[model samples]
Target: MIAPAPGISLGIDIGGTFTDLVLHDPALRRSGSLKILTTHADPVQGILEGTRRLLGEASVEPGEITRVVHATTLFTNALIERKGALTALITTAGFRDILKIGRERRYELFDLMLRPPAPLMPDALRLEVPERVKADGTVVTPLDLAALDAAADQAVAAGAEAIAILFLHSDLHPAHEEQAARRIAARHPGLSVTASHAIVREMREYERGCTASANAYVAPMAGRYLARLGAELAAMGIAGPLLLTLSNGGMTHVEEAIRAPVQLLESGPAAGALAAAYLAGAQEPRILAFDMGGTTAKLSVVEHGEPEVVFGFEAARQARFIEGSGLPIRISTVDLMEIGAGGGSIARRDAIGLLKVGPDSAGSEPGPACYGRGGLEATVTDANLLLGYLDPSRFAGGRLPLDRRAAQAAMARLAAALGITAEAAAWGIHDVVTEAMASAARTHLAERGRDASGFTLVCTGGGGPVHGYHLARKLGIRRVIVPPEAGVASALGLLTAPPRVDRVATLGRRLLAWRAAELEAAFAALEAEARGVLARGGWAEDAPAPERVVDARCVGQGAHMPVTLPPAPWPTDDAALHAMITEAFTAAYQERFRRPPPAVPIDLVHARIVLRGAARPLALPPARRGWEGPATAHQRQILSGGCSAMADIYSRPGLMPGFSARGPALVEESGSTLVIGGKGRFSVLENGNILVELDA
Candidate 1:
């Protein structure tokens, strides 16, 4: 085995259907990638196999891999499948129902049968201790140790595997929660303790409690999986640091990831967004990143070479698109909107006798009908296959042969139900999913006050390039960029990601009564905590200066907006600091709302710092091995404008830079396929990205 080299890195991303592996050797400015069906029962088995095969094919030594970056849907699946460990929550007296009583608001106001998501921890498992803290951080009723002991004992006796502590006002004063965590750990050595303050350190009992309990629920399981994977990789003669990507588009050491698995809930999608940003950051600074995998479509906005980050997001959503219809988790995550529109999204007829395509998927176990996995339901992939958008012989690099007859049978069943031809039903399924994705993109960009029409679209994932053309057209987006190795882009993104950590503290204070000394101390503490977390990865010293932002709002406002501090040194003078913050707030508010702040005092809610270690530079191959013959490999009929047309098929690598083609044309690669409409004009860029321009 060769010695470890700084230029060699490997990345693995496990999605709903596929496990993608990318081995990058920057010294050679080349990357080798592979995709295999995900092994849900033991995801590490697939990862190990994929990693070994990739290295073997490239004739590379396992010991040469300097680092391994990975992202998985394991913990996220656990939450959604309700397969996590038996968890229990302990809160302040009279607050045992906080998780159930989430703001007392219905996500669906008009629906009488609106059912919120069930709590991860049931009522029977939630127990409160004798403790009370005033909203102002003053202890009212001291914590009763005997009461805490009784609750812990009762919970353990009832078969609780993990415990969560969420005391009232713990965001402001974590003493009680910390003490309870210590006691619980000492008494129950086998149980994992997740304290709310340690998880969120912010206000809102329901959200913080949900985050803590969810973390505790998945911590033990995540720890064991990480340990097993790490041990197996080491046994494979691979000497490298193992890291996992977070929902915030940051990569952290396996230890940190195991400690807080909830932060990884949406990690798989985050990698795709990061990859899109890096691939198109220079060509198009602002873009709508569209990643369509097997089971879901993830969309995010990237501006100025960075994907936006949200302080909180919902998980295991009951209603896939509706906000607040899922477990509220307050952790930093890439700002993304996910819709149940993907290759394997099952297509069916709704109660209204109208056609609907997914929020339900066939997934890997019994993927699409075309996979010949005993799936009889019509799915997006089946539709695409029937529409000739995919080459059955070369799908998944011919590793998994597609059965056209199976897809036809599935589409025929749906077509018969809708009283339409199998071909018509296939087109309908395609358009329905596209419309769903476009509608979601419109809403997501509008919520951020962004214009989808003004942004280019960067397509990634297995299904992204196939639907991106129509999705862009629907949104009035003129330009779309398809990067190299588009199907495994998320796994590739893991290689480009840097070590990052976000630390937040709830500092509910009035900006009017600013105390520079106290605020500085708080900032110091938050930054230190963030640094310490990064230190475990041996990357703190090389990281760039951390970014500072505060969540603030008018005293009477219902929601707080995050305000980025202007580039300046830490202020010492109270008046100067106040002025600086006030100006920054007004400017940001004006930009967002087109108006100045209301005539009310501004309240600072949370202080946050994001520490980003420098990413190892990734080199895109200057060119690829293209077909020696004509670019047009063959001609296939594709549905264009709800009509059939013979589209010229081209292999992706066959098209060189400055090569231009007019559609209808299909660009096929081993990883993904791009469908260009008749009105589209496309070209290959110098870096091997296919740039598409569509006329409205």
Candidate 2:
């Protein structure tokens, strides 16, 4: 092991199928990377393995890692699998029915079978305490200590390993909830407790309660896993700070992550989006970033050089598309839409005589049927293989030789079910799955008032390049860029992220005639809280300045839009601050609703502050001056333009930047393959990005 060194950053991203690690040494101008299969039973194994490989490749000691930035899907999986510790929710007496009441709207209008997601806490476990606070931060009912003690006793006896305290409107005043949590923790010495006010102080009782419950739900798991990981790294002589990525596109200390694991639920995907945003360079704004991993595909809309920011997202839902059908959580997150369309996405026909691709996947264990590792179901990989979109012998840089016969046999089942030839069925599955992804992208963009045609698609991840061109065709996107080492893009993306934290408070006050001094104090408090977290994450004293924003809206609006705020005194003049708030609302309103609402009293719903440390740029490998060689004539028949054509096959790595491959050619990469159709021309970018352009 080498000694601890400065200017070295380590990033680890644990996805459903793979755990990717990247080690970057800024001073040396070099980076090392590894992508290993995630051990579902124990994700740490994958991390350790990947870390060891990266360190070995870089010839550096574990101590050389000055920072370890981690992102994992463990919390999201725990919620989806119901594998977290037994948890109980403690809420204000009158708000006991908040979870049951929900927002009172069906996700589907016509389906009578719609079932809202079951609450995380059961009625028996949701012990209520006698306390209340008005929406305006005014105390309504004094907390009943005797009743609260009784509730705590009941929760402890119920075998709860953790407790969540969420008093009604606690965002305005956390005194009651904080006191309740302290009392409960004191009584139950070893039990983990989560207070809604501490985790996320915002409006909406259901979202607040749900977020706290989720934090408590994953606390035990995160704490134990992180502790073990830290020990493992220590054993290897790495003494640097371990930072975990957050859904807000920032990194937090491991201690904060252990306390609020829900914040890391969508962290992995957020990193990929950040990478796309960074790679888009000068065209950052109005770009669509597509990340297709082995288990899932995530889409994020980048507007004005920044990804859209979302305050709330759900997880562990039975149905993917149905809103209000999953565990709700309130956290600052990079706005993203996910679908189960990736390398291992299973493809088959449903009972209604219709073809279906997935929301279910084969994952990495058995992987695609073509991998020939005991998987029986046909998947996207099998479909691609059957259609000559993949080279069976050259798969994964020859590390994994795909069994074409296995892919064919699997597709044969689908062919029999659909009453079509195996070849035709395979092609249909490929086309339909591509259509499904394109449709999802279109719907996601449409809802946000975005047009897919105007944006350049940046594809990454293991399965991204395989489907990038087809997805582009379906979306009518003329240009697509597939960067070098596309499969490891997410891991590389992790290195470009900053160490930061987002803190918010629910004030719910009107600006007109409101006390500006009090508001300034509240903003200061939030900023202080954010800075504290940043400092704990080991942010350098001379790092870039922190950022602050507020979630505001007109009094009558149902939703709040984020508004940026200046640091410090926060505009001394009441009129000036009001004008700034109004300006922010008008700009955000036009972006979302396309029009600002008529004059109405403006309200400051939530004050948010973000602190971040400066991040170093990623190092790019210089491009090769020439191609691997000319493509050899291959007699494989492929369906294109409603006809069959013989295509030529070529190696991917052999192709150099500025190299152009015409349509009717098969370009094969290690983890994926690209099928260039007629009228399509593919060129490599300066940073070794593969650009595929199709003529209309």
Top candidate, metric TM-score: 1
Q: Considering summed lDDT, which 10 consecutive residues are worst modelled in model 1?
A: 1-10
Model 2 lDDT vs. the true structure?
0.79
| TM-score for each predicted model, relative to the true structure | 0.98, 0.94
**Can you write out model 1's per-residue Cα lDDT over 130-210, one digit (the tens) per residue?**
999888878889999999999999999999999999998899999998899999899989788999998889988888989
The residue ranges of model 2 lying beyond 4 angstroms of the native Cα positions read 1-6, 136-140, 540-545, 566-570, 626-643
The alpha-carbon deviation from the true structure for residue 648 of candidate 1, after best TM-score superposition, in angstroms, is: 1.1
Q: Candidate 2 residues 1-696, lDDT tens each?
A: 121235688888887777777777877667666777778888888788878877887899877778787887788878887889899888888677687777887777787897877777778898787788887767778999999889889988999889999888788888998898898889889899999989998888888888888899889888999999988987888888777778978777777888788899899889878778777645445778888887889988876767777778888765776677786888889988888887788888898977888878888788888888898888888887777777777665455688988888898998899888888887777777778778889888988777899988888787777778888888989988776667777777777777777788877778775667877888778777776676665564634555667787888879777877666656788888788778877887777787766788888888887777776576555665755776674547777654688887777777766778688777776555666788789887777677789889
Best by lDDT: 1
Q: What TM-score should be assigned to candidate 1? A: 0.98
Error of 1 at 358 (Å): 0.8
